[model samples]
Target: MHDQNFTSLPDLHGVPVFYPHGTQLIWISSNGEITRPSRETLAAEFALGVVLLCHRRWSAARAAIDIDHYLDVMELFAFVRPARFVLPTPSGLAQQLGLARPQQGEDMAALLPQIAFILLDELASTPDPARTEAGRIATMMTAGGWKWGPYILAHLGLPQPLAGPPDSRYAAIWDRLADYTDYTPQAEPGTQPILPDAARQRLAEMLGENAELRLPQADYAAAVAASFDRPDAGPNPAMVLAEAGTGTGKTLGYLAPATLWAEKNGETVWISTYTRTLQHQIANELTRLYPEAEAHESKVVIRKGRENYLCLLNLEEALAQMPGRPRQAAALGLMVRWAGATRDGDLTGASFPAWLMDLFGRSQTNGPCRPARRMYSCSLPAL
Candidate 1:
């Protein structure tokens, strides 16, 4: 139904999102009333949910959008499903895709198929719903997946762009984020590396002076490799420090050696960075070089200051945790969306605004469910 008629996001933020449970479009309220939302509300929410799941797939498909075409197609991304809800494909992927500039022929009507297709697979997997108001909608697209443009044209007349509810909190957190949570299929973890020398040599070879463009900087890399290969020593592992100007391959120099050592030792390598962007940068590099290890978020993982990752457990309790607090309802709604949609759970998942961050801190009534540092081990911890 949405692909048929709605052009913009349904006007449904804070209207209460719901899912198809068996047949009925029922919402269990705070008082436990089984209620049904209005037609517009249900349509908007189902649309939002579908997009939330498709964010990463959608981003991967269009990651490298050319800047010239960015504005022309900007409206397509605004407050819609998925893109607005989830973190985007990282900048590295986007730039690599080399998104093409919008050609002179492109327009909204021309882009409908692209927009609707984002939710195609998601809708197909959606549980069956009774042919109630929402169910009738399922009838059309469910029969055939990804008919967004035709469905919208035949059913929905025009999609009008919508703004999220007036509540500043939803916009504060969700607005800055783009959906990119899709694309990780659970892959087998690689075998623990048995060859320390092999790992180091591999790193050196990749970045060695003989390599293309002369990467590896043999001098810096040799020093890093030596520490890991140190013979039989004390409990305190050797640490070596070396510095060089830009273009010196410092990041890779350490990464190649560290990766190999960590794999061989079955130890966790902590790569600390001040910025989330750099954190993601290192993670991306690891993914490229050691995809299997990075996939498991083991062999290599990202550890930050902890406050940055959204706490799924604490976020769910925002309302019950502090009833009657100003903006509690809106904050809860926003947090719920972020919690469900985010993959990495980082505060930057949505470029989280400071004001929204305050809502997650020690509220007057409730404290954090657990220490933030323990978040990675158990994000959904009990209070």
Candidate 2:
């Protein structure tokens, strides 16, 4: 209904308009519950026209257009619409055909002429009333899929110029829209030891092993005994920055205290290291001794920032819009694949390089230092 009679009508957002042969007036209505004729909707309707033409293998079409063309044709409708168009072929089909080569300078503008010609050819070839209507309907779907242009046209009240070759100014507009391709058929805070007894014990051992410390048998016994006697035998928020001087059983000293405190205080005991070597040393030591703690340690995640959490929402949006580096794109893709099942935001499938390690910290919560850290009484005893 729209393609044949409404092609030349102005975009009035989503409103609809009708013209009668030799008639002085056209009927117009806003697209609400009633759905009036507008350029916004018409643009979408036209996009569907592109898709239909593309589908039927009609890749060339032409409509007589002039400076007045923009104003006059849309006058038939109720609103102005986006003047945007793609040239070589519709993005939907181009991707489908697997001929979606990277776009270049003139690709977008060049495709518009081809699409215009294609539409003209399709209209010329169609004979059946139902088939012709069906073709038009399909075009609507394809065009509607592209919501950006219609939105800009409707909201911004921009005129779709119908004059000669689009100027450099308009080329910038096209360039901005170079990659609106629809692709792929795919889908906070708080500390405290919430882990179960078994999980807690596992966590304790994991931390102990991570520090790779072996306090003297006497020290380990004393720390564990001290933890057992404390009002609560779990970790407290204590800052422990251990520097090994010569042969200080640094591993033993760190492990005994971390394990005992975490187990006793019932809180996560964060161990920040200045070097990757230290981080690994603690991890290896802890794992070697308390293998059972490995799983819990894995759960003891190193959260960085909100951006690291796979941000499935932002990822899909970015992909659709086309932004960021190739690495970013790849990271988002990996995130899309793994994020659904990951609660802690840890991606065990791939190793995050040291350079990328800092990216995870982007998600860290900002605030005054933790209260536990500020108060000595609350700080877990390091002895």
Candidate 3:
């Protein structure tokens, strides 16, 4: 994950600019002297990632983050950073700098803060001078904190601008704020307060007969009128090696218990199967069973590598370069159709041919189905 370009630059201002996964640093001085940190010192500081050189240095390091964490960090870095245009070096930038960019599976530094306070502050309190109020509000909503923002705005009596034609929703509010040219919010539907346990009772009634209707389940359901009654029982962390033959309900046995465990602990459960067929089957079965098991509700999401998803950039490039190519046209057509249907961008369906799957795997930076990043090797859980 260390970059060669990072090896070329002398550290500027006693600060070695490093990305989350990038480790190499070049030292620069006021006297124009460039010196590499000693290998011994680097080893002491960063065992695998440390390197020493005359003018540039490259180092290797080990990380303990898992693939999920790595992806989350990437997301945080990309859209959640407080400072606009502070994005990390993109793949294209790395290429321009002649540095080897870390692979998609690389770990993200754990210590880096990922949340942006500007978005939060604007959503909760006031607008930022740098960002448009609309942009700040939209970003906060997309980042999943809109609920609180709207509620707070309502309580504060701040007027949000109505958008679009004057004949539209904000016609009245616009009349009031038109002179000021400030945005005004259209009135949102008022909510009526329900009985405290109404939702829980409804959920319980919905899951009435399901065996998974334990306290946690009942508490979640609206029909079952009850207080917290379930004891703390969850899966113990362990490395399990099992070899079960056909006719064994291995799929159900694992899925059922693991789904309940996930619900109880509020943790994600990752399931990996050896064969593509098994992957599809397990995902489909889990999806089906989730609705039936009302108390222990779970959502099943199948995630594959990015290549499996329609690569808009690559597709655009292909189309622009080969407008008349029959193969390209056909590929584009198929991608369009698949984009509408595929869930989680997994291009594995009965209609999708095996050859196409192979082609996608080869042509795209499609990562492994399961996150097999080195940092996650030790953290993978057993079914």
> Model 1, residue 242: displacement in angstroms?
1.2
Q: Rate the local accuracy (lDDT) of all candidates.
A: 0.39, 0.32, 0.33
lDDT of 3 by residue, 1-383 (tens): 11112233222222221232234333322343444445454334333222211101111222221111011222222222221222233342234234455354121111111121222343345344323332333322222222122322332343332322111111111122112112334444322222325544444443345635444443223221111123222244233354455644455544544444455555556777667678777766664445554422336655443444433334334434432333333233334333323322334544343433321343432233332221111221223
Tens digits of per-residue lDDT, candidate 1, 120-154, equal: 33233445331122223223222222212233222
Ranking by TM-score: 1, 3, 2
TM-score for candidate 1, please give it: 0.46
Model 3 steric clash total: 27
Lowest summed lDDT across 10 adjacent residues in model 2 is found at 74-83
Ranking by lDDT: 1, 3, 2
Between candidates 1 and 2, name the one with more favorable TM-score: 1
- Which parts of model 3 have CA positions greater than 4 angstroms off? 1-237, 292-298, 305-307, 324-327, 351-383
Q: Positional deviation of 110 in candidate 2, in angstroms?
A: 42
Candidate 2, residues 210-298: lDDT per residue as tens digits?
A: 55443443243333333223334446732223355556545644555555555555545566667655655666666544577656455
Q: Give the lDDT of residue 25 in candidate 3.
A: 34
